[model samples]
Target: MDEFLKWYFSHNPVAAASLGAEGYDHTLGDLTASGWQTREREQVQWLDRLSAAEAPSLDDAIDRDLVLSQLRGSIALASWPEWRRDPAVYLSTIFAAMYTPFQRRLKPEAELVESALSRLAEVPGVLAACRANLDPDLAAPLLVTRGLGQARTGRNLLTRTIPAMVEDAELRARLAEAAEPAARAFDDLVAFLEGFECGGTWRMGEKLYSTLLREREMLGYGAAELHAKGQAAWSELDARMRAVAVGVNGGDDWRAAMESLMDDHPPTLADMRAEYEAETRRAREFVRERDLVTFADGEECEVLPSAEYTRPVLAVAHYLAPPPLSASRRGIFFVPYTPDDFTPEQVRQRLRTNSRAQMPSIAVHEAYPGHHWHLSYMAGNPRTVRKVFRTPYFTEGWALYVEKLLHEQGYFDTPATELAHLDCRIFRAARIVVDTALHCEDMTVEEAETFMSTKASLSPGTAQGEVSRYCAWPTQAPSYLTGAIEIDRIRESFQGTPKEFHDRIAGSGGLPLGLAEQVALA
Candidate 1:
């Protein structure tokens, strides 16, 4: 059963084609295709069968708890296809998500080009659905254009790349065959984008925005709620952050204090690596010392570089969680080096270029006692179902929470590092504001970008890209803050109860949040 789940989840055509899976994307492009539909139906059937079999086999309460957690997760994916959007949007999203990760390990002979080109030809049909579902309104075209831009993203990555790489002859030959098909797809995508007319006068009506909000809240919560809580938490956290800097900055204004403290003890890229290593060692101690976690000896990870294209869009550092089934796939952390043409001091000040303030905090969030630790446990959990239905909100929330946990445990004793911690919180708060103001509030693209830049101190391009993402996809970003806070609240609620949130949630077998239906649902 575990083998089945692993095989199903890991064979993502998006990942496969992007990495050179020939015809893989084409085979899966028609999500309603017979084979795809059959496999989905069978997956649902297997859950029922597994539930009966796994339930009786549990020998103890803990074993039962683990099994149920996994089961709930599996059921969620099998049931919740509504989260999936139209083809152009989905493909572009696939391209965006995959572009950065694969550039680092992409091969010339890979089948990705073959699969992507074949699927590229299918973009027209996918857009047809968007047109049908959204027409009778002018805003439909803008939405359609946004959808098409996404597919073009994948088409562009494949068309502009793969051929010139001096790596794989066979792949190059295969990629050549895909050239025409890829070009055609690119044209279709461009035509869609060209027809877009929403321009500056565009506004997603309040009712439309509300509909988006409801569907979004289905995955997570509202921004106004998160924003209110974040403002309050920000004040509470600012005090703690300042205290962490008291030795050097005299416990004054945290932002100023951080700058004063960081003015000294500057670290190079190499120093950042060393800091990361030291923190990894301490993370292991934090887990074992407090008996807070159980880490696998078999599971370990190494930090690597962010793929060039996608690296620009993400934080300076990010973690790649391993598949639950692949024992060999270690959890990975990528710390990127900035492209040349900038001064070293300026680079270090940029979060993407600086590893000094980022490496430790990132490792805490992305690796040890963070995403890797939790995910590996989820993977290894006896409840195979819980392992499959991962919620980004739940997973990211836990990771961000663990980051704060480790910092407070005295891992970040320095004022400079402590300031970085608050900066992270600020980043999430900004996400709350950006995500809500753009989608529900219907702020223009430029207005949303300014909100992040002026308040969060984010770069314009970074802010704009993030706003585009929030507008296109609602409620997903706020999960970083909303999900984390929910975890904290649940943990607090459970403090006096017989079972902890950790235990209750884990015991519930990591069921998809959707399946609870609601605590009082009749």
Candidate 2:
């Protein structure tokens, strides 16, 4: 296991850096054809080795299964044309490679600065590899469009956000010097993408999509069944949201109530961040007072503005978990403020979606007892495989589950806040419908956007961005509600208090729902 992990981290340095593995901070992964071939071959060998070995204990068995699932998922998708089609794959890798060192302060400033410089020097080569690997004839039009936007954002991150993050004058100067050429590499990528005649599709279709859910996520349901389930869940949540809306505003129109709530947001982005920080603190205290779950020693979370590159997809807010292997377990809850370049109407729409009534639920979901809290416990687990491999089925499901848990405990007891919380769930249910439809049910990108806009009640721009993300990442959108439902089932069979249940499930790490069920039942 140790040998395989060392090889894994060396080839996938960005993932290694994210996991807090040392010795990969200054490097980026190889994105060329040879790199992929080597990784695929090694993964198959490791899978075979692990499969032939007998487990010494339940923990060993679980770890062995976890690694096997990851390896199988990788091997299953090895034939997919992502490297040859998706420009975002390479661009996202470059951004994450440069961004991770800046996000985590585990290393000294000087060392981190040097690491950034080293990664900066590799930007051109990585982009060159991208140019070599990508076939314009196979490129997905939507992905190429999104990739261009990401390239622009990467340029902004290198020139603006990152340089300002360095505190020391000399280090800032050194960073700026290295960042200049890196920014130009992004410009070159933008130029290449602009000149391409990309007309490929993004759909994974029924077979590969079902394989992802079954083999990778370890789910029993196929794409069609999951789509039906999503439809049913969305209908149920819609009814509940309408009933709650009637109580909040003396009407059964949930959309009107949501709009009213949106009008109650902070007047400015700075104020929004302040409110989120305060709400995060309050949620933490409530969890401690209620003894909701155990917080790992030194677990801390800070609310901050989102980086420029992330603002496109993560429009409202998202969480970044701490490196499980690092001493610092502080997470970051990022709120993406409306970009200055947006039209006046766009700014209003963005702020409205991130309204004041929704702040408590958002805080709980992304911080306190949501991602930060859950991931902190996962980070403290002794098993390295558990720490390294995370399925969205468990992680996203746990985050969504806590939202309801807190609401049931009277944390979001007010009518408006309760409605806001339900709104969040409704959105997740809608994700199931859209995600399956887009990849498996032949739903067009435009149709998915409209479903989100009308059915989910998202703004058109937000809906468009959300649909694009679903196109890029199949099977993840439905994980929020699907995981929550699975967790609820596990809780029903468990003979323990809420804290024990929460801790047991979370401490099991982000396993597939099937494994998580085993842990919970045990």
* lDDT per residue as tens, model 2, 299-387: 99999988778776567689889999777789999987766578888877887788888999899989979999988878989988788
What number of clashing residue pairs does each candidate have, in the order they appear? 17, 0
Tens digit of lDDT per residue, candidate 1, span 396-465? 7777877777776777666666667666776677677666666555466778788766545355555665
- What candidate 2 gets wrong by more than 4 Å, as runs, is none
Candidate 2, TM-score vs. the true structure? 0.98
The total number of steric clashes, by the backbone 3 Å criterion, in model 2 comes to 0
User: Each prediction's Cα RMSD?
Assistant: 7.3, 1.3
Report residue 227 deviation for candidate 2 (angstroms): 0.7
Give the TM-score (vs. native) of candidate 1.
Answer: 0.66
lDDT of each: 0.53, 0.86
